[model samples]
Target: KPFVRRLRGDLLAHGVPRVWLDEAEIDIGDSLIAKIDEGMKLSRYIAVVLSKKSIDAPWVKKELDVAMNREITSGEVVVLPLLYEPCDLPEFLKGKMYADFSKPDEYEAMLAKLLRRLRIT
Candidate 1:
């Protein structure tokens, strides 16, 4: 709920675009390579909503793998993850830094922080 709401608000506030793998135009068929390629090609930045559920999801893991690779290969596709619920963030995201959305003010602050982190502010 929070993820979709925040994403909508972000889309409204900034005309920055976003895409979901499930709703993507391409046919992935659970292919790792295909998902990675599509994600990198279609999105300028990737926001992974990390939680125990998403963190353990195979799709999320694959996307992160692709995002990490893209980060290395092109230094593009910035992966900005928001905490939907309290859970342990993976090592990769843990090191890069993330905005906490555990509180209302923190969430809003994180939203602003994300803009600044991405240099949109």
Candidate 2:
């Protein structure tokens, strides 16, 4: 959660217009599936923060499926994989170039690369 929070903060600080983080956007009585779907649809890019535990999460799988489907339908890249830990990536995301934040020292450089991709600067 800290990693995500930090990423969100940095993205916002760097002038990302909007960031749809589940914890920040979802309310107590909201429908999780609907909110996630809406977020995926509205986002220009979906950043999947990958880790050992997250790779096996059901919600992650569902989210990835939705993002991949959107990419197929829209005929554009919609998913950005952010490697936060050393782990084997999902087959679908294996070919995508990712911003690696696994090394603490590389955070700034990786973030810069990500911002470039997002055209934020």
**Local error of candidate 2 at residue 113 (angstroms):** 0.5
Of the candidates shown, which would achieve the greatest lDDT relative to the real structure?
2
Model 1, global lDDT = 0.71
| Residue-level lDDT for 121 in candidate 2 | 89
Q: Which candidate wins on TM-score?
A: 2
Query: Per-residue error at 120 for model 1, in Å?
Result: 2.4
Clashing pairs for model 2 are: none
> In model 1, what are the clashing residue pairs, if there are any?
none
Per-residue lDDT, model 1, residue 66, is 78
What is the TM-score of each predicted model, taking all chains together?
A: 0.73, 0.97
RMSD of candidate 1 to the truth, in angstroms, is 3.5
Please write out the lDDT profile of model 2 over residues 12-106, one tens digit for every residue: 99999999999998999999989988888789999999999999999999899988998999899899999999999999888899999999999
Please state every model's RMSD to the true fold in angstroms.
Answer: 3.5, 0.7
Give per-residue CA lDDT, model 1, range 32-113, as digits (tens). Answer: 5675676566777777777789999987898888788878888654788877778988888887777677666676678777
